[model samples]
Target chain A: MVAVYRISAIAVMVEVAIQSMSVVFGIAGQGKWIQEGGVLDKAVIEAREFVFPEVIGYLIHGLNGTILIPLTALILLVSSFFTKVPGAVKWASLVLLAVAVQITLGMSASGLPVLGALHGLNALLLLGAAFYAARLVRRSRTADQGDRLASRA
Target chain B: MGMGYAEHGGHGGQVAGGRSVTSLVADPRRPADVSVTLAAGKERFRLPSGRAFDGFTLNGGSPGPVIRATLGQLVEVRLVNGSVPDGITLHWHGVDVPNAADGVAGVTQDAVRIGEEHVYRFIADQAGTFWYHSHQMSHEQVRGGLLGALVVTPPEQPAETVDVVALVHLYDGVRTVNGNEGDVRVTVPPGKRARVRIVNTDNGPMSAWVGGASYRLVAVDGTDLNRPDPVRDTGVLVTAGGRADVEVTMPEDGSPVRVHLGGTTAVVLGSKSYDAPVVRPPATTLDLLSYGMRASLGFDPNRPDRRFDYDIGRRPGFLRGRPGLWWTVNGSIFPDVPMFVVNEGDVVRMRISNHSGDVHPMHLHGHHAVVLSRNGIPAAGSPWWVDSLNVADGESYEIAFVADNPGIWMDHCHNLPHAAEGLVAHLMYEGVTTPFMIGGTEGNEPE
Candidate 1:
């Protein structure tokens, strides 16, 4: 369960960093410099520039909501292992690796939309794997059925 | 015949072709002395011939006639203005004549008045598809049917079976094939080889195709004597001022074939009934002269003596304040004030700077150039060979080729209307035998 949490946190951080970097690079290419323009103006211009290529790249690479959500779920599942909640570790690790591969493919696609879409799909698979791992971890802990009842009381 | 004078709007008129008054006659074989008067106005004239052609004409017909001339032959054309509210002059498209015979209203020659006449005498030097129309306010005159094809056949062409000329005309943004609207149907007998020459005298985009068959693109914009390239699938795209010559062997007997055009899906065929087997020969490798290759037995690309950068730019609202003002080369309209001049054997490398806000297909009248680079970067090996190149806005392309054929060649945007507006210029070679007899009017001596 803890491992799942850690992986999910890492994925979120990576996504945010990539998105921010894309925004910055796009603005520079379009000739919108912060020193030359006001903050609001520059931000708006930069945001507009970042939209098309990035969205197209992400969609084509398949790195969308499906990949991210599944990855988060897997993180939650794996973290539950240490807490004696369920089969978290195994599923979380598998989901984490899948999501990681998806993200890597998306980054490496180099303007190809197909890889971006694949990246997005893998996130969903990661979430499913994480959920399954969590369920398994919880079941394993149930071996102490009597203790569970006492603790519940 | 005595010279009879008529006064109209403070202009003098003299009887020349046996007709005292300018009139639009129906006969194509009228006496050389019979002067026909044509007036350019907002009103329309119905054509006496051509099916479904009750078109608006400045003269008597839309796209009048084919002016025939042999290579190295000199012909005299007398232009008279009878009905125009303003003075006008005609420019012979792609003919390498003297500067004075260029017929530019304000630049080359003065506009012929309502009752006056201007005579142009020029020897047809370069052979290929050329056209003629009123250069003054060409947008309106060309639209009104003052344009026609001028075919100059080379004297050295080997004997061929059938000689056919297809003068393609366009009106109001539509191509009128064989006097009919839309794609034209051309019939070729089975097993027979034929030469197809196309001249685009329209103001819009155009492309040519043969349904279920492929053809070889031979010459472009009248630059012949070069090796040919065979094209498969979706025939050549000919912009407004461009021309293409293709030779194809007819299909087997009893097989139906048709010609297709871009933007429309139906096959265009003639109304004649045919019977025969449709047979196309097996594809074989054609020995074509590559852009950089020089061979004595095949077409050789011309070597350049100089090279320059030509930037195509467009300011918004250039056309009558229209927001979508399109394209320009070197910051000037076609036939700009200072034209490009070159001597024979000079290989010129022209870097095209495209900032026109739209894709412009640029074509040179007398030579095929090599595309050397794109956007300041060298092109990959074996770039697609073409005489006409479609350049996108904000992009830059470089083409280098030799200047072998002499005469004044026009380098302009292939868009017809744009060429009319000023997207044209000349390539001149020194010491060639020119067919133009300039200043040959009434008492002027030929230079």
Candidate 2:
């Protein structure tokens, strides 16, 4: 089945580069604790130390948009319906509708920072449609589908 | 041991820092009274209002000369450095000098480099008013000009009536006093008595005032205020690296007295043709808490065995990899802040609290503290002491101090970019140990 549709298009291009490096390292770790508690007064009284790598980069960018891009788009829609190829069901349904609009633009980017810069330009359009749907599963293999059935003999 | 250091010992004795914290409260000297030498160059100054910049000097004066001495003498100095760029030391800010001359560059030495030469020697032993800068990257060699003026006297050098120093700097962005920037005359004859001293060295908090005349706040930071009193309509301020003095008198109808220090610079004193008043710093200043009268803090700050607090604030973290909006200290940041410790005679008692909106100053290098109350009230004047305080924002003070100068000192922020944006913190003492290291590969970075 075209090698199981190239292993679900390499897990949807590694979950679009790990959810775009977890929102740019969670905007540089919550912009450095909102600029170190952005001062309110009563000067430095420290002791709040728990910052584990910006809390595991927003918990792996919220589990790569709610659990690794919906389990790699349901394993690329059941390996593009058992690989019947030919536009594998519209490129696996446009990579599961761009990972469901990139998880609703990362939950509407915390109330629209221009939708968080359009969720970082929609992760370069979900890594260029997941590297062109993993190169169309190597052009639908099976020797390019017997050279497209001998060019429609 | 020759990266070149001299050290000696006695001001409380530990003088080498294997495990030491200073404490000299005076009465030690054994020969050596007043031998100055300073150097440190790389100038292009000129500022008493005339305008010119590119600084970093000492013997060439951007404020690098005036050492003086007498009170308990012993002094020395030496320092050479020659072409400042990433090497220079000095730091006597409030003059406790000991934990190995406390110059503090990569801790207490290592940075006399550039052309090298160090000495120091201390012992002016608590007199009145002090100053000295360049604790390495002191926010860029003290705002690019290095610093100076450290007086002491009182061992009878009183021919009285005219002493002046004003030091107040802020170059590259203008605003000067000793390095000029505007009207700098100071002749003083009319009714005599001038004094002045001033020295804020920028980074914030300045205000000076005298105008037509009536002064007498007489010393602070270098101590000696006790019976001071006589004001006019108020102005004083001076926090940032702090220092005051004042005195005034002048106008016996010669009428010029200016003084100022903030805007249009000023010093004028005895008639440079009066008419310089327009500095504008009045949102309420001269509070010195109560202004002066209390007394005897000989000890017993309600009994502080040690108590810290600190507080400050402002978040968004990662001081070591460069993120923004830092300045925490107690809530942590900067190499993880909080060290405080203490023991040398331990009296401690901190309680700072700023809330972070702004105004910090703070600066507790060797030790002078004393404030004892602010938002919670208390300080009925006179024991204010301070070694660079201010703490504005939401405010909260309560100082105290008596660990009697030991070793790992620093307690940060004289606005050196808010201690380079982390706000800093330290106090160590219990078995000091600094071989010196802040940014390693050895470039110090002492803020």
> For each candidate, what TM-score against the reference?
0.53, 0.29
lDDT of 1 by residue, A1-153 (tens): 444555554554455345445544555544443343222211122122232233344342234333554456455544545654444455555665775586566554544568857755665565456446545544555666768898899
Model 2: how far is B333 from its true place, Å? 41
- Candidate 2 per-residue lDDT, tens place, B212-290, comes to 7778887778887778788876787787888888888776677677777664566777744656464444456678888
Q: Write the per-residue lDDT of candidate 1 for residues B249-291, one digit (tens) a residue.
A: 5555525444443332223332244322222222332222232
Evaluate candidate 1 and give its CAPRI docking class based on DockQ.
Answer: incorrect
**Worst ten-residue run, lDDT, model 1 chain B?**
B1-10
Error of 2 at B257 (Å): 2.5
